[model samples]
Target: MNGIDIHNYVDCNDMFRAAANFFAACCRCAVAEKGVFNVAISGGSTPDGLFEELVKMKDSLPLEAIQWFWVDERCVKPDAPESNYGRAAKKLLNRLQLQLDNVHRIEAEKPEAAEKYEKIIRTLLPLNKKGLPVFDLVLLGMGPDGHTASLFPEKFNDLPGDKIVLKVPEPEHILPAVPRITLSMQAINSALEKVFLVTGNNKMELLKVIKNGQGNHYPAAGIFQAAWFVCCKPGSQD
Candidate 1:
């Protein structure tokens, strides 16, 4: 939460269009500079609009050179109605002409789900001098409770020290699931850039509170190091 950048839209439709353009431009720039674009995505109602917008611009963007990964995922079957990957698959991935191998999914069904996803990330991402993977861009969404990824305020005890992926139990009334695999704070901050897609009137007051440095109870406030924070909401004046 490095002071959120608010880009107000007249409605959800307008917000989605702007978000799609931002993502497309970012992907194009990354591909031009690095030959490929690696992006970690978040799941939420807000992001669903963005994903739908992205689907319409498949030809205009660098879909072929983009490698996709999830920032976090619910512990459920791939085709489960509640599965984020499943939603993304039907909304975007399944409609694209991109290679199936380019889409890396978190194996939530694996015995050691978090560890398996971490291995997958390590195999695909470039390592730094400290042997940590550095991502190009990470897309995040803020929950109504201000939790981002799987780092709920009440679930701090479940935070991982491995500097990779971890399984966090959902706090009651927060997420509607058991354990979820998510990237650690260290991993998310390691990305060269980050983008937050937050929308709706319900989020307006909380966004203001977070910017004023009053709400530290939420884990999303820990993202002070993120390079960029983008907001999409109606009449939202930063």
Candidate 2:
């Protein structure tokens, strides 16, 4: 891989454990260095397992000292099944003892959600010299078509690289085809850590493209210094 560090796992469970361990370590390090760990997480089937694994390590991780944010959110009410915040809240937030103020969910149903989220980030997280909020970690998941966050391949050329938050139009190719609000590439790349949780043999071909650095058309390939945690059948890398 040109810029990605690949970690292979025999199955999704093992990959989730490795991801959870990495998350816990990052939380501890960030909390120890500062007072809180600011992390932004994505929503997907892959991360659902990681969220469960994280619950098992609640005692080991600095749950109370960690500030959670969303990488992207579908334009739905918080209780909607398609709501990313709803999924995270059920799978992780409700399981941990975190500060209510630290859970920064994207209220995507509101028209001003993107602007509000951008303001919130500037108000809470530390800003870099470029004026972008620097997060301790930004956890992401790659769709089979190579989309990360709500940045789909069809809309790659349209995304503003300098924006903090972007209002994404409804994707025609992907499911839950609703409009979304997402952190822009500039915001995501400003994070201290960037990770992708990718599993299943269906993603092998795209992973190959991304690993060989030939996936410039794919939104996930635009991520800087991304580490991919992949799980698939043994020898699938060949």
Candidate 3:
């Protein structure tokens, strides 16, 4: 928490640029330190924008040294329109043309995909002092209900302490219905750093409540220890 930072952007484009720059810098640092950058990508409209920026950065960034993972995945086909991996592949991976060995996606359509992905992550990345994988960075999106990744408020406490990944139970009536696999709070909290990209006026009031410290009940509060880059307070623009 002491190292966490928060930023606000005037628009999504600005947020995307800031995210891309930070990610590139992190990747470079990871490469210099350990020869690889292990990052988890979040699925959502906001990250699509960030991925767009990443695509444009292919030539300048340390693309080959980066290893990618999903923060969470819907139990759908990898190419499904709603799939986070699908969106990212189209927006960034395809265009960046990074190595196949560097990209690890959750086979969410499989019955044991959650466990399988956990094992894959374990084999590829080093564990921190907590025995949890320390992702260099994990990009997170906050839903209107304040859910981050697939971790909803109602089901947060039920997550097993030792499990790195788990099948998410259905959300409490507000979110879209879909089976999801998510990294546990321990895994998420273990990241070396995290970024929360929040946008638009719809979330302004909720953001105010969160900033005022009245949102302890929200799932996003679980990672309030991470960096947050919100946007365009009410009506102002870049």
Q: Give the per-residue lDDT digits (tens) of candidate 1, residues 33-151.
A: 98888899987666888888888888788777899999998888999876878888887789886698899999886768888788889998997776777888888888888888988
Task: Give residue 110's lDDT in candidate 3 (0 to 100).
Answer: 95
Residue-level lDDT tens digits of model 2 in 48-135? 8899999998888867799899999999999999989998988889889677988999999999999999999999999999999999
What candidate 3 gets wrong by more than 4 Å, as runs, is 1-4, 236-238
| Model 3 lowest lDDT segment of ten | 1-10
User: What local lDDT does model 2 show for residue 120?
Assistant: 96
Return whichever of 1 and 3 wins on TM-score: 3
TM-score of each: 0.90, 0.96, 0.93
The models' CA-based lDDT, in order, is 0.78, 0.90, 0.83
- Give the C-alpha miss distance for residue 45 in model 3, angstroms: 0.9
Q: What local lDDT does model 2 show for residue 93? A: 93
Against the correct fold, how does model 1 do in TM-score?
Answer: 0.90
The full ranking of all candidates by lDDT, starting with the best, is 2, 3, 1
**Tens digits of lDDT, candidate 3, 128-151:** 877799899999988887788898
